[model samples]
Target: MKACLNRTIAAAGLAALLVSGTLPPASAADPGWHTSSSLIGTSKYGDDFKRYDYVNPNAPKGGTLNTTTAGTFDSFNPYIVQGNPAAGFAGFGGGLLYDTLMEQSVDEGSVSHPLVAEAYKYPDDFSSATYRLDPRAKWHDGKPITVEDVIWSFTVLKANSPLYNKYYANVTEAVATGEREVTFRFDQKGNRELPKIMGDLVVLPKHWWEGTDANGKKRDIGRPTQEPPLGSAAYKISSFKAGTEIVWERVPDYWGAQLPVKIGRENFDKRRFTYFLDDNAAWQAFGKGGFQDFRAESSAKRWATEYNFPAIQAGDVTKSEYPTTSGQPMQAYVMNTRRPLFADPRVRKAITMAFDFETMNRTLFYGSYTRTDSYFEGGELASSGIPQGKELEILEPFRDKLPPELFTQEFKLPVYDTPQAGRENLRAAVQMFKEAGWVNRGGRLANEKTGEQFRIEFLGSDPTDERVATPYIDSLRRLGIDATLRIIDESQYINRTRSFDFDMLALSSFAQSQSPGNEQRDFFSSKAADTPGSRNLAGINNPVVDALVDRVIFATDRDDLIAATHALDRVLLWNYYMVPQWHLGKVRAAYWNKFGIPEKQPGYIGVDIDSWWIDKDKEAALAAKYKGVN
Candidate 1:
């Protein structure tokens, strides 16, 4: 067989070369488990390293699981932005096919287990994490998974993937201490800092990727995606039909199958991800038993009214709200301040006043979503005060800093159901427009100085957005302003917004972290705005806001972090970088009524797939219950 540098090498060679009597006997220098400093001698656990309650510590495993997603992947190279879910699915599949240094838990919190390494050594606060690679570890084809592989993989991934933001940002260097030992140093001043960021990155093999570039010079692994590519995630590309489907077969006798994340999470015997262009089509196919797991992301009304299976009615399949105490940050309509027309605060406020959110909630969402007032939603690290409580105590100090109207409970933007309030807001909007030198002529607002029509484009992603945005645009048209709806593909939508090219785009900013520290920078920092591909669409550059974000990120105590976040929130609210929209409380997903989903899975959704299981008996019963074809 031809030796492929990028793919996993034979494990026999690895075991023979590194672990087969050639290396020195194991000594005290071998990597050993070290507890997180945050927990120290105490048994208390941080949110980062919470234990799962669902899976028995020693649960039996013998089931074939299938999951359906959207997209096709071209390469096993998980480094580049391929603009497809199949790429992610393929990468995950490859993770099982190959092993990185560490692995994340099902909950994606803390305690990375050893894959190639026997143990991980890090300070309590996670300032640095060092790995003593196991001499016995090998790639599927038998090449040793070594220090060179680790360094090469990190350098390549950090340079290519934009999503690799927090992965190795703190790392100062990765140095090989011995033949089977490597130490990762951090730029931060804290213990356990490295572990928090040490989840598996699917390290690539140096032997495969260490080559020359197009100029015939040695390929720079550190030059972010500049070279062809290299990675060590689970599944490698067997074949790819772009825009159609991607196939990735398992690497024969792959390494790292015993890793913690894999032992529990990525245990699918055979994994393949198929893509469909239309979401409804995909859902229907899943309904007909074309796929094992299907995600429903359409209208809630459709889920309640339209989607009906015999198993769901007979109580054979579980159909209940996935329990969630705290709502995740969600979809919102944000106005880009880069546009000259939206630069004026009054004009932006006027545009926001035109939206009839209550009407849309009643008609479209059926009052399922909460009207969001700030970036963070309830129960988040950033959420402070729904007019009272611990959040209120934090908000009290910022009351003087915030606008006076924002202090009152009723000081929120007018609800669309109240026509009188809506009209009142329109009247105020008219005044603001007049102040900005705009004249109302035949119900059309025109700039008095330039005689330019005050028009704005509301950009959205696909037909779903068009449905919700059209009504808002209609409201604006009625208010003597012309707001056109510009619908685009998901890829184009992301590309345009990332480059800060839109006038007013409908967006749903989901917060990935419990703390609002990083999200704030991505959404509001001038540096992020200036940098391409960052999420700061509004180009907001307030020094006060930047300082608050810095303080919030570094603050140890929860209370101090909340205070700093609230201060930042007030500034964001005042700036109106985005006109807040609704928070769709928990993830509104409907799976095929075949499997038995646990009520108390985990606090977070989307990433906790291991908590979801195949109830073989229930699935068999359901198949019998709904015997006939659709």
Candidate 2:
């Protein structure tokens, strides 16, 4: 039924039937549905396959699972420009309360299974992609999901949301060609990731937004709203106390319940989220078994020191660590290059070298953290040693724009792993600062011409972030840099960060992909530099970075992909745009013992409880034994 079905069929095995004149008319040639994305080669399971291997297909689904968060959510509209959506708002324990066209498989990399759409078709050149919606797909209110909904979703998202607009920049248009078929045309061709990204579109119901409210006012999809939105997913916002707590209940007549992809997932009958204003308060509430079922420990100090509560001792709370093999988090002291002070590469490098990671790890972190050196740390894609092979070839053209030392020398952060650590590093940092036209004057580093004292403010939201930043601030002060730390409220931080209003902030990019596609644009593209809310926090607008980002996105094969990514990683590292922070390979988590998890867990840590179900026996026994605890 898709616009590209005939072309896709001709490229497949069905071409022989048409060529031999054994097939009926072109209208009679029914196209087969796909189980995964086109570039993923083959689905691990055939068309007749059962549920995924990592889930418990027969697991019973009925129990209230509770979760805790530090910050209160102001609105339910996460898709818009304003407000943070509550966690677990979407059914099946993911994001927002809607279904994407296709869902990616957690067990396998780069694979996606149909969710709203039963099948999709696209040409080999990837000029366009078409999705055929499942006839069974329907919204929470029982309206059938149509091609109109898909088109409307694309239109509104691109217009209102900054993230969505930048993400879908290359996508030309989305058109509903048939009752069941919706096609997305791309501006650029031969990029295989286009089709998969099109599948990732968040389909919003058209009638709901255009409809009149109880007060006879039309709802604005562009603004944040407290009114709960309708979704086609497995769960709905059953009840809420606004910023305090949100509870989701399972939809009895969920359309996707019987689908192969839905089996063994979203096992909870009632999922709830309770929010606290502070991290410590949330931690204490979780420790005392006060309206929380699961807690992921963020502070290493707390994980090692403070998990000695009565619940933990009584085995009511189960603590565990899952080693992560996913893309490394690039948490960094991001230097704003738009500011004149950090525009110089030498000054940036000097600032990075001045930080004392070794001493901090010894005293503060209790030796649990690892000093991160690469943007793509702890992965094969990470750039190590010197670039060679195809990676070297990829960098050849951009050699003039890149750092000259990238070809001749290897990139290494100044090691403060020995004695005279503070003095030695500070000396080198002072020398670099002097080279950048700043000198120590009146016990402060001042600009040579302007006489402006070198000062930087570490902007943050959490009060506890000061502990992590204070040690670094002390080190910077030794270099005669007038360093200061300021903690603002959550809303202020979010608004300020979006507008690029800060001297420095510890930021993290949560983007991870086995294929590393177009999202790279939002992260490092020159176009995204001026745009607010982009992940390009350092305001990187170099042509060299832009070129490398394109190379990473349009890579032809696995070899070419790795080569380009490595090259990009090297250039980013040598540039010293970020003062490399620390990373942990695993997530430290603690949850109640009243649930049954899957026999096999996915490589990803968050999926450890994806197939978890309430064990009635354990629940009943715990209730009898520990009465009045929760």
Candidate 3:
């Protein structure tokens, strides 16, 4: 993220440099690192602020943080698409190995505290951004980081990483403007979030990547490798067995440890991630103390019935459920509109009706989820009732191209709690299918003109998901449509989904932040429909959707952004692009009692694992308590 620590020199403090709220000026268009809140405002934290209030500055640092996850990793590389990468790779842990240009504060959504950059700033128009580096930053091999590494990292990542290529599409140039400064010039202006998004870029070490390995084999960023790559973060890869586990050891003298943003974080001596292909196996391991740390339960049935395990009853494990304010993700069975069978919105709508969320929530999920009704579910931006005011003004031009119901109806999922309710919903679905050239003949659904029987297939990687998909498939069968679940491995699933090769698949898109921006393009824009690895799993290609996504990204203020996002959500729902799933208000977390954490957690994050450190006395007590109990 930086060639060196800017505050590492004689200035020694940010307050001395930004006493009047201005960073060193570079040019009119490209300002050097500066303290800021918005594109045109001051940051929430003053220049003299030491560390985040959410973290315990006096927290002790020692002991390992263990993680349990489902899946197998084939490579240690996180940038490439060649293999599955392991978890616990960044913040809270080192993500436990790489650092970004800026560190976003855990307590606030809109504010950011500088880390490697010392300070960063853009112009009034946000046409370009310039970063002034801290001079003390270094790579794991003891080599000083340089401006060349920043520029090279941007170039290679934009060229090879699909996500970055799309996310930074507007940024047209990246060149070293000075020894410790690099400028990223954008082709388009007025994108308020671009500068903030740029700070999220993960900087890779160009020197180690281009140099030869221990056996004289040159490293390639495009390929996957078992060899742990060099990093300058607080942790480095200590050891790993590919597909099994990866361990990172904390660096005692980490370069940015004393930086204002990192004062009380990364408190673990080591962090270990253990992977299991089976979810049940992973649960078993946690129960037997194979990995003694934390677990977040995803399945409602499992959480309701499986909490009475020995360790929990022994009072060694603590359970917590937090009511979150985070946006609920739009999780659903994405109907691939690129495929011919799903080309008609009517067919997709009919398939959505076949799902009985009420029954599943009651019988299968232990009534743990609430029905999701919007792309921006559980948030202020979610459209409700009918369109009006500024939002309606944004949608008026496309009124002819959208569903008439967008103006008259509130989008709602069908209720199928009773047999009669299910029948009524099915009847409505049948009418829509009839209009789309599908009809029931001799108890089998088929195209009325072509006499072709309808068949639907679900592509999945996790077998445990079958609990939900299989019942939906059975419901689809009752409607005379032949549907089946096709479970594949993680790699195959990723490749197929990326290429739009499957008809239907389960996907949970990332929840939107308070300010929704460019990422919406990758999720629903027409351009991303054809781009492989894009999040537009439904292959959305409507011109209207594209314009709405742009409007959301280019929104000028909070009101404008909310109105545009509401319009976008309304249009997507009325079209029935995918069946909406369910959401939970709280995150269920369980952890061993040997760790000490802050009393107040980050409001947005719910759980701040970074602020936790091992309690030495508790760890010793746990070892003595459970020594032969497993």
Candidate 4:
């Protein structure tokens, strides 16, 4: 799964700038300072650039945005894994409650502009990075944001959250170099991405968190709390009803409201997220207007057949697919290797062969998705055909350790076009299982040594996943395997998955960026596998994978990063750690026609809800239509 805090930035741009002789070579003694950063190429926006091209600076803002989430939340804090965090509390670009050091550009893959920090400087070697906080930056209480707060936030996050621990592992220390300046030092040099990623740090208020609450009890950063924390962002938590709902009110005098990055964003006066027990309930609420304003459709079955509502028929609602330039996430049924039953790669491969994605797509998905083939699908970094050149060189040393077929053949999932072909694949799967010391004895597949039945359970929190798992389970049973699907509550699911307590997850996704880096470690590294609450759900512990992850992280240029990622992807595919599912290239969404969207949408993130404004005339018309119907 993708880390909630993950954001992309460019590193190759610095190298290109040095090569072009546009700037003098920088070193520790003479660092170059800039207002923006990028990891793949030069930042599209320069020092004089105003707002992003995708936003409308003139758009008026005053309406409320009502959205719904499928699960309940118990805590306001999203930084720690102690409790389920409320939706919109925190995510990419600091969500609604907090502002990060920099704001990510939705249209660019690997670029970000200053938000809290006015300017930043880094050496040629990227050993350390320093940021000068904007003097105008302030918390809700009107106190200026300090370097001490930046240092404290980084120190506390890295020590408490496993996700942050793995992400900032390379960052050694944060020190106050000046009254408004803080520097983050790295453990090693030559990592161009480190300086850029530091821009993603969500700055927390040191004074408020450490101070006492209204009850006179000291607040703890590690514990879960319902009391809304202080924030520097455009919105603050105004009200909540435990697991039922949460509402955010935009700050009238938000300190950075006029900043370049915030000019045309956070357009809504209020943002409310209503919680439902499941997707079906949420869908019903969305159809009954006023309960929900926007819905991002995830189920193909529902999107294909269930949009005949009155609002949609009357043109009061708009349903459309928005194309995106973002990388296709790896959505799959993840098998936990830490479990004894899935310890062998051969057994995992046999199990994967039983899944008939072609049939599933035709019947259940309405042919809306494409079969995923790589960990980094829909991106140029995905490995295709056979390994050659740099990718081959990276894998040469591990030739004896890896599967030989991986080197000779292109990796592709088994396809079952006909019933006969399906049967043939099943037979092949049984034979492979037999070679791995499993056999069908008296019509039940059991281990030859232990005589234990090959039982597996697919766990899921969503009803939609259960629909897909039911068919897959039937296929597994045909092989004489005891397979079952278990649908649990959202809270229990989170607790169980974090502790690696499940045999298999019905759905686990690994979201990728155009410029992959440190986040790869949390997804595939051995250290992450051992860390509770980390994104490494499969528990991959291969040393070769660890080495390859480093290669991707420490890659010096864009080409080197792509080649390294290709090598890593090939190795991961050959391991059969998970059964690849399918993905859609476009985001399917339905929303009321009362909002006005910008002429251009962000290419990388698709729809930018923050850039949208309420159209008064349309809102009035929609209200009149609903009144007439009533």
TM-score of each prediction: 0.76, 0.91, 0.91, 0.94
Expressed as tens digits, the lDDT of each residue in 163-194 for candidate 3 is 66767788898888888887889998877677
Best-first order by TM-score = 4, 2, 3, 1
lDDT of 4: 0.82
* Local distance difference test, candidate 2: 0.74
Ranking of predictions according to lDDT: 4, 2, 3, 1
| Structural RMSD, model 1 | 9.3
lDDT of candidate 1 at residue 608, scale 0 to 100 = 48
Candidate 1 vs 3: which has more TM-score? 3
Give the top-scoring candidate (lDDT): 4
lDDT of 1: 0.53
Q: Candidate 1, TM-score vs. the true structure? A: 0.76
Candidate 3's displacement at residue 319, Å, is 0.9
Clash counts for all predictions: 32, 0, 15, 6
lDDT of 3 at 617: 92
